[model samples]
Target: MSVYTTVSRDSLQQWLQGYALGQLIDFQGIAAGITNTNYFVTTTHGRYVLTLFETLRLDELPYYLSLMSHLARHGVACPAPIADHSDRFASLLAGKPACLVSCLTGTDVSHPTAAQCRAVGEMLAQMHKAGATFPRKMHNPRGPHWWSLTAQQLYPQLPTDIAETLAEEIHFQDGHRFDHLPSGVIHADLFRDNVLLDGDSISGFIDFYYACNDILLYDIAIAVNDWARRDDGELDDELARAFLAGYQSERPLSQAERDCWPVMLRAAALRFWVSRLQDLYQPISGELTYTKDPAAFRQLLLAHRCRSEFWLG
Candidate 1:
């Protein structure tokens, strides 16, 4: 139900003329994501995905498109952007910025195994490695500044308990600025739905919309927050450890990263807590949009606050 802006066959066929892709056979709306409108497109030649931007502006699109292309070329399994006749991957489509990308295989896992978590960790590390060489840079848009600003907007309407919890966490994060840790391009959002598994290995990582330059550990924390979370909102130690093991296999963490582990974990939790709360309160009007439950992240944030430090071995 994520198709916000509908596209008819005729308009899509005309748009396809800008590329070398053959005649369109069929297209179906993908009902998985929450941010943008996505469709699985089939042509005589091959299958692809068409994403119509909902909130992102055209000027800020090149960084994401280029990052995906950069990652794909460097042996990272990600959707490669398809360049049109003019060597452009993005264009105005149905009055919105749109682009077509190579569609990948595999289903989003519900209950991920330690092995699967390991694979995701490996891919994320690989992405970070590849992203380091990318000349362009975009700082994390939802970093601490966003957490504070968004919290201010939420306080007036939020319950006192939630507001107090958010304020305390934000203040705590302000004390530690992880500037010295490893910095590079990070997929700020790496939840289960953003990953697809084929057998024991990962088919690929999808959704690079939130990719940006930041402390590498933050990316790991974000992934662990979602991928390693359990039914009752507690972390699965086995899975989280497996994920960290897989990542370390590719790129080892520094002592500084280890020291800041708990802070990074709580930073990741508070970020999503504020976001999910915003989505719950000031929801955007979309014909097909999915709003996740804020309760899980809230519970997770509370759980994280109880732990003072995290051990990385």
Candidate 2:
């Protein structure tokens, strides 16, 4: 069974006809995402991805569409949405807005190695550099302040340890010490599933829903946390070295970026922890869904805090 929300074949055909994508020969639902309903649509013309907007507002969509277009033009390896015959990217589907994007090749690497992490880091660096001049600025939507408030509301029964950690983090956040760090567009969430690898090299990257105006170094921290670290809670020195080396090969990070890496790592860990805990306690209502363990990131956060000095060395 596919994780994508289902629609009758007739309904799908009707929708395709409206977009002039030709008759739908066959389509398969994509089970890759938890946030949106997705399907790989095959038509007489070619294959494309159909995405039904989930949590994003209609007003918030142009940022993603524009971002994708910008990245595609700037030599970024990512999917670009295809416009319909009428030059419209969105259409109503089952009473919700939906859009189509060209299907990108390459497999999603579940267990990426250190070399792959390096490629991803390089790509991320290039992505941030290109997006630095992005004209339209949008909020992170999942920043620490937002997560703190969500923690108070959703996880009111959070364990004492977790609650205390959150309180301390909030206190530090109030000082706005990190505000002076380099700021730019950031892909706040880029888990393993969001990145695709061809052999040991990254072939493509997807899922721009979390792209927003934030610290560029924080984006690197998120990638390192997911791509360069392992489940046993140890940061692989080779992975970190390879990844950072690759990033510096492209758009080199400034001294400020390096200096703030540890704090950014801590912030990244907490953001994921809050979201995972939200899913664990108040699971979203859906037919096919999987919840991530907040404990995993909590342990990772602790580990990073213990090795806080290594970041400088």
The 10-residue segment with the lowest total lDDT in model 2 = 304-313
Candidate 2: tens digits of C-alpha lDDT, residues 216-242 = 888888888887677686777777777
Candidate 2 pairs with clashing backbones: none
Off by over 4 Å in 2: 1-4, 18-23, 154-156, 284-289, 308-313
Q: How well does candidate 2 score on lDDT at residue 37?
A: 84
- Segments in model 1 whose C-alpha atoms lie over 4 Å from true places: 284-289, 308-311
39-143: candidate 1 lDDT, tens digit per residue: 999999899999999888888899999999999999898899999998998998999999999999899997899999989988889988888899998978798
